[model samples]
Target: MTPARVTGTPGRTRVLIVGGGITGLAAAHRLRERLGPDAEIIVAEQAMRLGGKIHTVDFAGRPVETGAESLLAARPEAIGLAEAVGLGDAIVYPSDAKPALSLGGELLDFPAGHMMGIPGDPADVAAIANAKERPDNGLPILEPGADMSVGALVRSRLGDEVLDRLVAPMLGGVYAGDVDRLSVRAVMPQLAAALERHARLTDAVNEIKRPPSDGPRKPVFATVDGGLERLVTATSASARAEIRLGMTVRELRQTPYGWEVIAGPVPDPIKIKADAVILAVPASPAAVLLRAVEPQAAAALSGVAYASVALAAFAFDRVDLPERSGFLTPASEGKTVKAATFASKKWPHLGRRRQIVRVSMGRLGEEALLQYDDPTLAKTALRELGEHLGMRLPDPVEQRVDRWGGALPQYTPGHDARIAAAREALGVHRNIAIAGAAVDGVGIAACIASGQRAADTIAATVVAADR
Candidate 1:
């Protein structure tokens, strides 16, 4: 890869990328690979550091994931990227099957016969009753088999006992949002597919559960040995683009020849010019940046909203919680905490006897316990754990709090349509592109895929220029 250069000719296409998150970094790396020694690319980051929400911290000698913990099993994109960066040997899987749920105040094993949150037929499980079913009355748990929210779906199929008692809490731990609003299509499409095909979620789950034959098995969950930040560090080292830290792009405008960027007060704030631009920032910032260049695109970008979130990681004696690795709380119970993970139990290498526990609170736009002082938040989190786990510890050895103001875009029912319209409008522009988790799926894999595709688009356009 060659260093980026600025050329004044209209034909020489220089690329500018906004945002230093995973998507932006991945785009920069891909651009370097495809453009070889020709194109000039620059990346600008608002924050002091890179790797937006992919945060991992070391507390009391244990690795705690303050943000995203792992990538999905079926998705190859994240794992592939790790391999490309030579971190493949660091992949580690956790015990996902050990997860539990907290109801009213009791821990319940999640019902065994369902896919994601959706159940097969509520009638099939003898212990579980439909949400509409009456203890002794002549009514069913809910309106007969009506499509509903994940909360309602679990309630109707697994019974209010399972919905409030189990399912909701488990989901709360992962998504940190109102389960009712987190669409099955967006969060768990496989479970949704079961609902669409088998008419009962149980049948779909059962089909996937054939007894395991003797064969090689792969790990279901994975993370780098050094930690997830290694991926970011590696990408940054290999990127050919001119990456500048602490530079915030305030706005973007198009010129007859190419594009001009307005960045925060650098020596030459308005001098950065590019023939093409990739807006890899979150929807909130991307909306503001595209307004002048493409109003329709800006409107679409702004329409995609995000939820605020906070995470607290605590380290303690490993034997504190002897139960399962971790669990979630259901929304129906109206609890402040969304989920909790038992780190020492989940990852043995985190500690032998000293343990790490991570508690995540609040969804997009919700107030989190992290808003309080560190001691107050830590105490509050442990109290909830004691109540749910029926065990208590003196105090946490270490505590860390991380807050994301507008992260993780909520994909509502019409999300796909809005994104399609935004992309269509963007097509009118000659060298503008958009890439981020807001358009594609969330998680590390999705971000990498989005970034790589954006780079491909630029590479294709440049090839056409030569023709």
Candidate 2:
């Protein structure tokens, strides 16, 4: 595709951001904050609406999330952004409901004092423990600059029962990835760092889980009362950047003045010129856009893999569920549904007018289940829920299935290295950076931080050019 003619006016530092998800919107907001009204910022989203992978819809006459339901408030990015965008008062925490685990067709309480299913105290999981002894002495000394699979580390240090039943279910719920392929450093950095200092895996987990101070503890997770999608709307409004929907960026090339973004339909594509660019899309599209400008970066990004999962939201008229919030099924159980969340119970703001629950299905190498029609997929989720809860669910008020294809980024072993290589290759270019779940952590907090970092980098470049 030929480059579209440059329309950027002189004297103004034009910054073009691709993708209008939370990452892109966050970047735009940061850019506007740093550069003020002097900078011209534009965001192009291929989708018709904003908030990628964060969708909320009207169900049972109430706003229910079809995608990401909560934000990790432990990190300040998401909470800070929400407060900045005037959503602080709307923030709501989960109700007092503990999550359970589905084991041997029985719903059991998920053991506490564990870091990602790695129990600090073995007695907490005595019911499921198969290992004869807890490695109290600690694990082997982990050398500096060494990385291994989380599954391998847990299995060697703890046991297969711990890895399969506890760690796998918890981590799998977040990443939808296989523990054997997930990176210890990337997925569980704190534990990885602790391993270097302590010989035992349990000891490391215990140290990591220790409270830093006696300060008032914050909620583990939070979300806007209306929906997380409201954060997107508020951020986009605050950024005040020109948002172009249904605009697909095809290619990127460096120009003498700055950068040129070739986008729009193939038949009649448009070119956007900017002094800086923030690529905040997924790995596949980012790879395609960077191939022409930075081939090595493109290659590194291409190696990033993604996993798709489907959420089936069901609103029941009358159903009896345990007082607990939800349950997670280990892959070892050979279950189709990985996890289920009792939305109404977890989020009190969702209200008790209608019982709302979400069933999540799919994992790494489980794309076949996603091929089924929405109805069929919903049925599968309901069936699994029935078996796990030991009660037949009566479908009633509303039901919806939301499919997220190529959504969750898998951080395999050496994931950080690949990201570093991509960033290093792109360092040669001026005012060009990549941001999103692909590079940073996958949580909302991480994505916001990554976007802000990209914006800061480009803003600094613009200021340097002015000098």
The candidate that wins on lDDT is: 2
List per-prediction Cα lDDT, in the order shown: 0.70, 0.89
TM-scores, each model vs. reference:
0.85, 0.96
Clashing pairs in 2: 138-200, 139-199, 139-200
Span of 10 residues, lowest total lDDT, candidate 1: 136-145
lDDT of 1 by residue, 83-152 (tens): 7777778777765447666766776666655555444445433343243332322332223222346755
RMSD of 2: 1.8
lDDT of 2 by residue, 1-467 (tens): 56455566787889999999999999999999999987899999999999997888898887898888899988899999999999999999998898899999999988778899998877778887664334455444466657899988888877899889999999988999989999998988877788888877767888989565688667799989989999999999999999999999998989998999888998778888999999999999999999989999999889889999999999987988788889998998888899999988888999887899999999988988889999899888899899999998897578999989889999988888888888998999988999999988888889999999999999998989988
